[model samples]
Target: MAGSLGPGSGWTAAVRRLLRQFSSAQRPGSPGFQGLPLLVEGQQVGLVVPAVARELRAFPNVFVEVTGGLELRGGHCPEERTEAVAGVLAQLRAEGRLARLARWRDEAYEVRPSFGAPALLNVERAAAPLLGVLQFGAHLNAFVCRQDDETGSWQIFMWLARRSPHKATYPGLLDNLAAGGISAGLGVKETMVKESWEEARVPPKLAAQAQPVGCLSFTYEEMDGEEFGAVVRECLFIFDLEVPEDFTPQVGDGEAQEFYLWPLNKVREAVNSGSFKPNCALVVVDFLFRHGLLHPDHEPLYPELMAVMHQTL
Candidate 1:
């Protein structure tokens, strides 16, 4: 029987009693089933439970409920099941394993479901609004990689992307690499690399190592007040490109600026002087410096870059 730790609430107690009833219904010698985790789509909720195949399938968030039970992995259960399972979840939530306990809000969308296509589009449009203005839309990144002669560090060239000059990126809500403003959005390393390839015609083989090292969010609300420059807003999703030393950047159309391995300090100076957009620059540079690839003596390449970084907040 699916019993829980400590006593349960009203809903939980009811379900526990029902489980006790159901367990009694099962044949005693029947082979035991393991529990599995459940993942709810509409909301970021999950729960784990052990039961026969059919019992867990009734869950709303379950995409592919296994035949045999799993080790109660994640997500919430059906409202019908919630009343019964809440006790187990409540106990787990208190222990910090299941913090985002929630009820299913929208079932219709759940019925059909989205493959997170919106997140992909939001990221592309957010990075480069007029990206579609061209025959092809590409969110560009210039990765500069070098093989250290002494240390033999063979890694990424430049994991930085140019600050998009396109004024108004459509999906204005995506503040960083994650929490996007659209109804749904993309949030992972490989996805960003694909976006770069799609937008810039970067050959797939070249972009193979595009990894998501980190995310830096730059928000512009300066347009909230009067007029003129105060009316522009944008969000840039930062991505890291790690490629072999021989890999050269492939630029499509009029997308990338001077493509080369500029010293980190020089890139920093450009950012500080406002010669470069601070969103990708600050985020990428800070990440590179933190990795020890940067020599400690490297000074502030762009002092004003700090201002740009701060102003975004």
Candidate 2:
């Protein structure tokens, strides 16, 4: 049946559409286009939109408008840069200049020119979009496999979590079993384990069994509201964990309200219906591709989809 995916397959269309939304920010002259390259230590580390740039201009000593773009004042080391930026962010928050900063988690995300580069500075997680800095996160796909007694075929079931309604973003949307942003001092695997335990009650021993898969990257622009024009450049590290069939995920930290174990087809349907949070849906799609549920022969845009998921941002 997996071989039947070919031209005109409806299943692949939804996945294609979702991927397009994430890639929209990359389009030439798209709305809320990154206003200027944000440079730190002579290297482009992020982007600054005009609104953010205007607010930044007020802090002349900390932020300077250079020939090509915006740059942090010179002679400041990474620690100094972080302190200067924190002061500016705190002032802005106090004055209510940037509305998004109100959601501050008091958590810091390291700013780097690239994924593995040394930290240029550390910024509040909520302010990442405003700065257009690349953010990193870890997502775990927890699943269990069972054999059909009669058909002798293996079926995979994934655990999906429904976000708590009171959440600040994507409230009540379906999400991966457990996921979280990598805080300034934590490693990728450590964050994954912490989030799994905090959000889904997944024991550390079991979470440690998760195997590291590849990653997905995308640049997304806020379309409207207070954060309009703010960009989110993110890379999510994906992990696959096979849980025992009897294991049931419990609500650990109130982030997730409930958990459901559904077959791959049902999960795909939710993705098509847009029930899953946008980024979580992408993670699930990557999982399906890796597990052989999605094939190139059936999906015409297979190559493009694969490429877009790993955009060189």
Which candidate gets the maximum lDDT versus the true structure?
2
Candidate 2 stretches greater than 4 Å from native: 1-13, 27-34, 224-227
Least well predicted 10-residue stretch by lDDT in candidate 2:
1-10
TM-score of 1: 0.38
Tens-digit lDDT string for candidate 2 (1-313): 1222234335666867776788777532656455688899889888877788899999999999999589987337888899999999999999988888888899999999998899989999999999889999999999998888888777888999999999989999999999999999899999999999999999999999999998999886774365546878999999999999889999999999999999888888888778988999999989888978888877777888787788878
Model 2 TM-score? 0.93
The lDDT values for all models are 0.33, 0.87
Would you estimate the TM-scores of all the predictions?
0.38, 0.93
